[model samples]
Target: MAMAVGVVAAPLGLSVISLVNRLQDIFSRVGSHSSIDLPQVAVVGSQSNGKSSVLEALVGRDFLPRGNDICTRRSLVLQLVQIKPSQDEFGEFLHLPGRKFHDFS
Candidate 1:
């Protein structure tokens, strides 16, 4: 499904993230068995170094679990898209398509 999102033009033109997001949408629509490799961003650092905190700040949400110890044991792929200010912000999971998660907490 195509989402009605707001597009912010970059100062110098289209950014790499915009291109990758477009490519990802195309590949996802094609199917799961497509053998195309898309560029990805990996957050690697020492343990308890605020990796999850950085991601949460970027997405402007506090959905990721945080504590004094390690809370995430599995890899997570997050797709962030810009939305219109008038529209309510929400999140969707690749495994559970069509369901809009309004609450991040």
Candidate 2:
């Protein structure tokens, strides 16, 4: 699956590496370099299929609904973020590919 996503993104001058978002988009010229926002990926599988285990391991959290016959009904956002310095404070930012930026510091 990882290889498949890499193949699909390669032809478009993109790579499948998990780079941290460094530059925040403000306003830019028409021909400026733009970022592409990858959609939030979710795991869709049957119950007891180890989906939760995978997610938990990735995020280092036990976010999977664990129980007998448990199934996830709603989508989950397992975002990776970075910390930043601010005036007399610190902040956090959501890591997206190249679209919208959200500040939940």
Candidate 3:
């Protein structure tokens, strides 16, 4: 039997903690800039190339289904918003042009 060893490294002057904090800082302002028009981020990759995995790791959730088959046939839209002053948030359901998710449930 053979064994494999791997090493993890961060870019110069940036630790893993700082990277996580940076992600937090970015997401903290998700819904605050409606008029400034910041470009959206789109993840594109072939099947099993870590697209879903990257998003799941960032948000720390297993919500995305595997991309091995046609199970995920429809498009998914996620809207992240700060529900209140605290760290509370909500993201679910789809939004239409004329319709409104008043409940935000």
Candidate 4:
């Protein structure tokens, strides 16, 4: 991972510095970013409370399906995705472009 990062950063001189700065910014943004806040939700309840089910429903994905219990003990968060209706004549969903999801949210 370190080698891959270095390879990508070697091409753009100033851009690599900016990338590092952006990573720092993402970590610094606590209250203003929902991307940073969603992971903080604590799914606490009794046995068979459907906490994982609720999370899967909210995120519109199978966050905790069957046979995926090995890594369920930790508090790691899954990636969140957003889809919007197409504005063009032909009906098709358009992706929200760019990497700065914090700005979009």
Candidate 5:
């Protein structure tokens, strides 16, 4: 259930938040921070079991594409990123380049 994931994710989330804070602190001291490549955590769960709904709620928008019931369509690598000038990306896949995926909701 979601509670299990929450229990496991809470610590990981805190650790990641602390790491980002430390990175920001370090960059601020450097006077000029060009950019940063942040790591991502994959949230794997049963298809259409409210996983997308949960993510959509967290993001406060419906950017992720939906798909048919019988097919996976696309494997999304969900990355929490800042939409700044330097960091301008929602997600990217390792196996594909310049290929953005979409699904039918």
Candidate 6:
């Protein structure tokens, strides 16, 4: 039944989440000072192809600039972290270390 499947999937999902958190911690400690080559995803398409829109939707935030004109001129590195519900949500930039951006806008 659906309930049995849900019980099995819940633990598997939690295990995956735990693994991701561990990997992120390891990368954070090792890659902060040195150049660590990590996996990347490139979204290539024609102009006005809704690429930015899709990324914003995936992140559940309207952080990307939107207008009729050209918005993004340089390459962007976006890092998304999953946090606990009790923890405060924020964003950080590699250039500006130790500063937490509470507002995405």
lDDT tens string, model 4, 1-105?
Answer: 446544554346455545554554456454344343322356876655677777768766553534434435545443332233553111111132342322211
Compose the digit string of candidate 3's lDDT tens values, residues 25-103: 4655475433434334577777657776676676665666664575445555443432347643434443334443333
Off by over 4 Å in 5: 1-47, 68-77, 85-90, 97-105
What is residue 66's positional error in candidate 2, in angstroms?
1.4
Q: Which parts of model 2 have CA positions greater than 4 angstroms off? A: 1-40, 82-105
The per-candidate count of clashes, in order, stands at: 0, 3, 0, 0, 2, 0
**TM-score per model over all chains:** 0.61, 0.37, 0.40, 0.34, 0.37, 0.55
Candidate 6 backbone collisions, by pair: none
Q: Rank the candidates by lDDT, best first.
A: 1, 6, 5, 3, 2, 4
lDDT tens readout by residue for model 6, 57-92: 877988877779889766776767667899888877
Clashes of 3: 0
Superposition error at 93 for model 6 (Å): 1.2
CA lDDT, every prediction? Answer: 0.75, 0.48, 0.52, 0.46, 0.59, 0.71
Compose the digit string of candidate 5's lDDT tens values, residues 1-105. 446544555466767866775675566567655568765445567767767667678777676656667344465544454445874345445456667544323
Each model's RMSD to truth, in Å?
A: 6.8, 13.0, 14.2, 15.8, 14.1, 6.7
Per-residue lDDT for 93 in model 6?
Answer: 66
List residue ranges in candidate 1 displaced over 4 A. 1-18, 28-39, 67-70
Error of 4 at 40 (Å): 4.3
lDDT of 3 at 85: 73
Model 3 weakest lDDT span, ten residues long: 96-105
Q: What TM-score does structure 5 among the candidates reach? A: 0.37
